[model samples]
Target chain A: MRIKKLSLQRSGLAISLGALMLLGACGKKVAPPPPPAPPPEAPAPTASLSATPNAVDPGQPVILAWQTTGATDVSIDSIGPVDPSGQKQVTPTDSTTYHLIAKGAGGSQEATARVTVNSNQGMQSTSNATEEQLFAQNVKDVYFDYDKYDIRASDQGSLQADAQFLQQHSNIRITIEGHSDERGSTEYNLALGTNRADAVKNALVQAGISGSRIKTISYGKEKPFCSVSNETCWQQNRRGHFVYEK
Target chain B: MSNSVRAIYRASLIFGLLFLLAVSSSAQDWIRTGTGLGVERVRLAAADFKGSNSDAKNPELLKTFNDVLWNDLDNAGIFDLVSKSFYPLQEPGQPSEVNFSVWSTPPPNTSMLAFGNLGVASGKVTVQGWLYDVKNTASPQVLGKQYADNATSEAVRVIAHRFADEIIFRLGGGIAGIAETKIYFVSERTGHKEIWVMDYDGANQQPLTKLGGISLSPRISPDGSRLAFSSVTKNGWEIMMYSFDLNRVVSFPRFGGMNLSPSWSPDGKLAISSSRNGYPNIFVMDGSGGNSHRLTNDQGPDVSPTWNRKTGSQIAFVSGRTGLPQIYTMESDGTNVQRMTDQGYAVSPNWAPNGQFLTFSWMRKYGPGEPGSNDLYLMDIASKQWVQLTHDSGRNDFPCWSPDGRHIVFQSHRSGGDQIWSMLADGSNVKQLTFKGSNTQPNWSWK
Candidate 1:
């Protein structure tokens, strides 16, 4: 909820700042710069923008050069405010346009330059991830309470998600590693971990996943995911983790 | 009384006195009182040995020997080891250099003194050791031993351990010493949990398996010829055996379900907790994993079976049939089943070498909001009375008794990691055995 509110406020401020900048350009021109004699009417701002190399490969840098006269403030749309008459280098991941606006005693004048980015072919569909990586990404872990083997009510959703993934991939066999927090003895934790693994296995079976596709092993408290002596770390350590077996 | 009976009684009395002079008739009393059973402790002084020659390895080997000897005796639980600062300026290397009057009085007033000398010649190291009685000036030497081995650091340590055992046996009432025994445990030093072995004094630590996977509950065979442990394999948790002679893992039949914590009966039979029959229960089989017989037909998990090392008639295990894990013992046929623990969680039931007591990890008050710890406890089977061996240090577990029943090797998290530790049977003289990686489930070798 806080994140949503913060982002909304940020966008609202952006809109108001954009409107203020537009109104400054449209309003009466400011007094001309001090000179021996002031001009009868402020000279209308003149602006020109150009890209040194208008086309390039993805992630390549492009140079934007702009010149403006009779303008006190100058800014680019995406690149933020910039010097009135200067060249700036920018790397564009995709094809983009550089929009520069100059405002002064004269009405604001805008100039735009576009940079075309070449797409790298054959890199989109080919994913080199192994089966184990895919398994880790798709399957989730089931957690339990301290010294209790029965699955937690909060973890039911996670177990169901795991079952759904396993059901979709019928040929994949998995090993359920039951782990425990380092509070009790190794032997008792071993048994407790075993029951935890078995409990998950039973849950998955009841959810329509084949029992033959699963195997269980208990690491007891031998291996821990976190080492801190607190509940937050212990909660992470006590889990039924999944591994994909070929 | 008959005349012959009266004459025999007098001769017996004389013989008993001579026996007392040689072996100390109070030996039985000290053995009983050692290890927290009583308060009396024998005052013993160990003097630094004088190097006979200036060989290059003499200093190193002598230091190893002396350190091993001193640690063995001090860890024996029956001796009040006198500090070296109180020793006389002149130490004895041989019987002729003995000055009993100085040792028997004042600062070094010790009843027993152990002094020895080490020398190297012709690529062989020789050690001459003696245990002397400073109180009895006439027959001062109680034990004299000479050992010669190849001039190596390992050989020197072995010789020292042998000499220490000789002294311990004579003074600790015929209960053989455990100074030379080995401890087999699971060490993760190599980035994988594998079986590792170390000397009883924590020297010469080495790994026995390179399976590169998670292995738990390593149980060395009764004869120390093979190691049986549970490892995660292609087929899941199975009982895997490694032969010490072949120096590799030997194949064993895989039980269908999860099999763990394989223990060896005194007669070389194997007992394990297997779920092949639907629920985890105690099962006994031949050493080669043949003739499998399910022992416990309970409703919950029954695991960590340990046999009576002395009688081999009863098997103690951890079961959860009562809603929480507890220690239970059953006969070989699984007929006379009895629950040993009446309170909170208990597991890792290991029978003492003497077959009268069991030492296991217990949490007398388990669950959250309770103020208790998981400590090792020793309980007498007949009386159901137990004594807490460890307190407030860390989670101590998997307490296995040395073959002599004088000491126990277990794992503790006291030093911020799971490491193997050993203490006297009475829970005194605690020593950390393995410092490197996480070590647990230490099984002392039968010998």
Candidate 2:
């Protein structure tokens, strides 16, 4: 009887252990599946840019409006960082493309709006078209480095472009204004800007453009393209901008 | 007995004359260096003036006169102004009304006293003012003057300023007081940068140029007849002259290619930075902008030329021929080129009227990631020892000397925007001169 009792106890222990294993299997089955691997793609950023009066006479004003979705940052090509959705009045001196970039968690999306400044507005189609357009739509501005009047390697292309336009339009007279970021004394900056304007003029003259056709002025931290006191804004301000006189 | 008595009296009379001469010469010596130049200040009392007339304008005119007189004396920077609380109960308007004991005692303890009276009658204002040495009880009065002008608040202020100046001249050595001087500066309150003028103490501010374009560096001609400034016009930057006598922008010969910062010599010659030839260089021209002779020939730009107003023999200018802008001095004829600043960036070297010191703005430690500031500094021309004038004040530049050589006016960005501020020559007693929108580049009149 003792042997039978011992055998009964052993069988009972085995049955209990088996039941524990079955319970562990049931718990595993009840647990939720590893949260479906977060969808590999977050919502991508979207951007749309438009320019009212896409075709303009030289120096005429145009409004650039842009909107973006899922964007933490938005910036324009020539202009600096701006609101995600806003409009800015720009007076482009030449045919230009404004590239807008919207960056977010997913990726960066870009959209562009082209403003076709009609340099041949009066010369080509109609006699009454816009005599005052000034060949501003033809030439481009050359930018320089900080506190430096020397032409930069990056800006060589711009100077070449400006030289090409001037060479084609022999009748155009232009003024290149040298500007500075508001970091130095006004008097000193004035001198710096003059050097910058002269640098550009010398380059154009070297490119076979007549020295008589070009004039230069140093605005010297007085007139600013942007006034936000940041590197981006300062980069825009410290430039040699071109204006058409005749 | 009669002859002896007469001889004794004559001897006493001669002794009195000698004593008076000695006292006067010693007083002159004391006055010479007493102009806020680290000397012990004279304890001064400016008592309220009495309204002596019953005209309807008497009370207002008296108030204006008293206020202006007090401020002018206080701004003179050579006096320990006794508080009004310590004033004697009875304000003395004339010599006879003064009680010397009350002023010289400990309660007031003043050595010099300024008192006055004002009146108005029949569209005219009249004032009588006196300065007294309270310690000299026997002959206490030091100055007594009378002024009359049209009965208006503005005229009353002028009278008060004149009276204050008279006292300052007598007591503050032979130097003329700056109370009547004018300060010309650049202001953008009208949505455009234009030249504006104000009294030395920041009163009567009005625009001098309404060119509706950007104007900078308004340096008044030494004779106060015209203003030379750089203005943006249809033909780039040009040196434009504004005639104070004609109250209009006059036709000055335009030097082409970015003419800027026209400074006038004491003899009426104008020095400007021009790029008419090619590079920006110093050009000394006539007052009419003719006889343009180039002074500096360099690839880097040279600008902001100022003359030694007292001698007119030398000029201090800024040049970037080196890596950065530095102060340089040369003869008026462009000889003896000497560099004044050794390190860092320095510009705007304005020579003091005395010609012994140069005041400029410097960034002693300049570059990216360097912690420093742009501060005004006063350097002795001979010794090259510099004293920092503005400390931790934001971007101080364009320091100009008052006509008296005892004060300096500069533009600072300390109080939010670039504003006109004036301080004593020793860099104390800083006062804001402009409270409106963004005034800068103060040039004190030569007078």
Query: Model 2 over residues B96-142: C-alpha lDDT tens digits?
Result: 89998999998999999999788887888888989999999988889
True contacts kept of 2: 0.35
Candidate 2 docks with a DockQ of 0.13
Best by DockQ: 2
The global Cα lDDT (0 to 1) of model 2 is 0.82
Q: In terms of TM-score, how similar is model 1 to the real structure?
A: 0.73
lDDT over C-alpha atoms for residue B200 of model 2 = 96
Compose the digit string of candidate 1's lDDT tens values, residues B298-372.
656788999998899999999988777899998988989999988777989999877877889988876544556
Best by lDDT: 2
Clashes of each: 0, 0
**Clash pairs of candidate 2?**
none
What stretches of model 1 exceed 4 Å from their correct place? A1-141, A151-172, A222-228, A242-246, B1-33, B36-39, B54-56
Model 2 chain B lDDT-worst window of ten = B29-38
